[model samples]
Target: MSTSIRSIKSLVPLLDRVLVQRIKAEAKTASGIFLPESTVKDLNEAKVLAVGPGGLDREGKRVPMGVQAGDRVLIPTFGGSPVKVGEDEYQLFRDSDILAKINE
Candidate 1:
């Protein structure tokens, strides 16, 4: 688990919801030149911090979520509700809203 996750374990998402922390944008160029904040692009990649228990189906059976905590996932360019815990910034997204899992 990531350090950021450890600090916010108390947050338990509900009913297929997921908590995610975005991967930081690069602050330097490949040539070692420092880039200004204005040049930094917000990435669509993020680390899963917490996952809610699977939701119930029509038959009352639990439908498991595709992703889990500790997984790196790809998110949409726009959407997801931003969350703030202390100085950290997190986002809440529905399991289906997550685009894909990043294998690394």
Candidate 2:
């Protein structure tokens, strides 16, 4: 499913910001039983979608971001600005706010 939010097919987030698509928790169990939404744990993992240009530093130098598109990152459960397009939701976070980059 395509989640790009821009009308022109590109969504380059601005300055030190990152666009992330959250990973939804599974609704089924190992034995093929269905689970209720309330029982599912909210996943903290997200896939990097689009990113902005690196932010500038006080010294007039560019500060590099730690995560990039296609990188899997760990995010906090309750923060980040939410974005909704159609019926899907995404998140926007400053690079400094991301918890960590997941290797897998």
TM-score of each candidate structure, all chains considered together: 0.88, 0.85
Q: Relative to the unseen true structure, what is the Cα RMSD of model 2?
A: 3.5
- Each candidate structure's count of clashing pairs: 0, 0
Candidate RMSDs in Å, in order, are: 4.2, 3.5
Summarize candidate 1's per-residue lDDT along 1-104 as a digit string, tens digits.
12344457788899889999999888999889999999999999999999999788899887899999999999998888887766888899999999999998
Most TM-score-accurate candidate: 1
lDDT, model 2, position 26: 89
Clashing pairs in 1: none
lDDT of 2 at 100: 96
Error of 2 at 25 (Å): 0.7
Whole-model lDDT for model 2 versus the true structure?
Answer: 0.85
The number of the candidate with the highest lDDT is 1
lDDT, candidate 2, 1-104, per-residue tens: 34545552265788899989899888999998999989999799999998888899999777898899999999988778887776777889999989999996
Give the clashing residue pairs of candidate 2, or none: none
Q: Residue 51 in model 1: shift from native, Å?
A: 0.3
